[model samples]
Target: MTPIRHNGSGSGSDNDHVLDAVRDCVLAVGVRRTTLADVARRAGVSRMTLYRRWPDLRSLVGDLMTREWIDVATRAMAEPAPGTATRTRIVDGLVAGVGAFRAHPLFRKIVDVDPELLLPYVLDRRGASQEALLALLADALREGHADGSVRPGHTERQARVLLLTVQSFALSLRTMTDEDDPELDSAALLGELRTLLERTLTP
Candidate 1:
């Protein structure tokens, strides 16, 4: 069990392999059954190699999900369509974010395979990924404010609220008990999200 003091070196590909192994293992045998030994075996690395970075299963999975979603969120926020208004850009960013969560393999596997492993992250304070999302949204909100498309309010606060709201519904859309007359399908919900963002941020 040799511990590598520096984690930022060749650890890059090794870490990716470990997380990829984690993703595959979760998708196959589920989170409860997955283990460092299993991930190491699947990753073709030693258990100590993983221990050098993540001490346990939960932290490994956290890193895996954070990696998966951060890439998706980056894509959704970075590339705004031509001629999109600032408000509309935020709307599309949020909506794209929801779509990213729904479509992500790790996300679906967690909900379908072992949801209990996900509850802690949802019920508690924001994790690294969630906080990162809030920051990204906050930056977008600030941009919108500069363009006079966003309403006068605390940018960071509004971004946090929006991130929490979107993550709450996005993560649990399948099981959330809404009292609205007729349930809104995913498409309709995105449409409503668009409308809500438009109204909330517009002058």
Candidate 2:
């Protein structure tokens, strides 16, 4: 996902207001039904204002997703117990991130109503958000290696593999879950994910 260039003049708060409108519109009618006019109206800005910032609805939505997902990952990574080992922090952050994404309203909305929008990122190529996440994971892995907590390897490759594993669980966990069976429920599966990640990163 290329970063959405804001060629227009606006404060950060102004941009946030527009994004808030977009989010509300998406939550109400999804991506297909949303229009520039709708966003402009809801945001109390002209369509030209939005046009200057984003070329199309897809680009706007892409930026929105990037903002949302990064925030989720950042929050998760920041909240681990103090003085935790690098490996433990990495594993706990990822598990918490998976859970956060699974429970996020916007994420649930996109998955339920605009899942096809995600297919390109999943199947064809990496997006900006995915690249950002990979960078974060790679950095953490490097720190883990320095601390003798993670196995020695190519940090980038290890990060990519960790991402692939967590991505699968985040996107597909619901499909495999059995609400009636506690052993197969989401929490149970997430625990398994935590264990898998810890083992993978541990020396």
Candidate 3:
């Protein structure tokens, strides 16, 4: 997904304020509760200005999720790492993505009340995040296969399976016991994930 270059009116400060307000509102009230009027009031921007820029709540939320949150995940995936260690990168990326999602209250609320909200995004029809993440993993897997460092076959299908695994792990977090440590669970899950990938990619 192309990073959104927010070329808002006036100055960078105003743009930053708007973004901050949107994020704050979403985190506080969730995606369903947040309104353009509320955002305009919170940001101290006129309703006309907010409307002119975002047009609708869905557009604003989509832009915020795509431009801000997903970009962070994409950059994390793009960082210089042991690309040859296919299992390590993919598991680490998935674990980190789950951690990031948990930290976002908006996501937590949606996933808690109605996970269906994520289907459109996860199914890759609503936004670019899913497609970008899938492509990233698929490309990484393909590269590993090409170099003979990782076994090859059904790279795209494997990527999708890994994606589903990550989602399942995240959704299962809520059912964990109080004794469970999220970090430890994440590490264990990722390790198992690496083992699975190893089996798949290592003939």
Candidate 4:
């Protein structure tokens, strides 16, 4: 296939399309195998255009992963169903967020083949993505506390700890054997988390 041509325009809609195209390619081919050429072909843009937006495959994949995580966090924190308990909502949202990480094949494969791929972003605990997620979780928790839904004292510290705890659960899921029932464990763990948070924040 001929390489795609570059359009050189950095419009918001254009960037969204590029990101969307990259997402599809990563999902289809996995991150390691998905080349700039592949993304261009799927996006219908020139390889030059993709390169213009993201100079290398690593940068493109990184951005794609970041965008995906942000989306997951947003969806997980969205309003829970009517009549749902606030504690349940928080636990379910966290469970869903962790599930997304465990299920994303591209991320799973990368971490499996080269565990260090996640080191700087997750294990390192100080990466930009981690910081962003921490802030997001803190904001979510603070809002809940303000509304009398979440537990109260030391919102910042507690939110950071909660996010780290969630990360630990996600990492453990990746190592679990096939015989281990992830669904059951996820439910039990989430229940425990909710109970802990309730006790910590209860008025």
Q: Which number leads on lDDT?
A: 2
Candidate 1's residue-wise lDDT over 1-203, tens digit each? 01112233346677788888998998898888898999999999888877877767877877788888888888877555566767778887778878887888777887887777667666765577777777888888888888787887898889877877787668776664344635566676677777877887787
Which residue segments of model 2 deviate by more than 4 Å? 1-10, 79-82
Candidate 4: misplaced stretches above 4 Å?
Answer: 1-9, 80-88, 112-115, 176-186
Report lDDT per candidate: 0.76, 0.87, 0.65, 0.67
Clashing pairs in 4: 4-46, 4-47, 5-46, 151-201
Q: Model 2 scores what on Cα lDDT?
A: 0.87
- Candidate 2 vs candidate 3, TM-score winner: 2
TM-score of each: 0.86, 0.93, 0.70, 0.74
Q: What is the C-alpha RMSD of each candidate to the true structure, in Å?
A: 4.6, 2.0, 4.6, 5.8
Which of the two candidates, 2 or 4, achieves a greater lDDT against the reference? 2
Could you give candidate 2's per-residue lDDT for residues 1-203 as a string of tens digits? 32433335677788889889999999999988999999999999999888888888888888788878988999999543557788988988999999998898888998899899889878888888899999999988988899888999999999999999999999999999998999999999999998899888878
Write candidate 4's Cα lDDT for 1-203 as tens digits.
00122234588687778778877776665667778888888778999877777778777766666666667767776585666655556666777777777777656666666465566655443544566677877776776776677777687787778777777777775354343676556566655655665575455
Q: Report clashes for each candidate as comma-separated counts.
A: 0, 2, 0, 4
TM-score of 1: 0.86
Q: Which 10-residue window of candidate 2 scores lowest in summed lDDT?
A: 1-10
**Model 3: per-residue Cα lDDT over 97-190, one tens digit each:** 7667666666676666546656664455525555666777788778677667566679888787876776665556556533376655656655
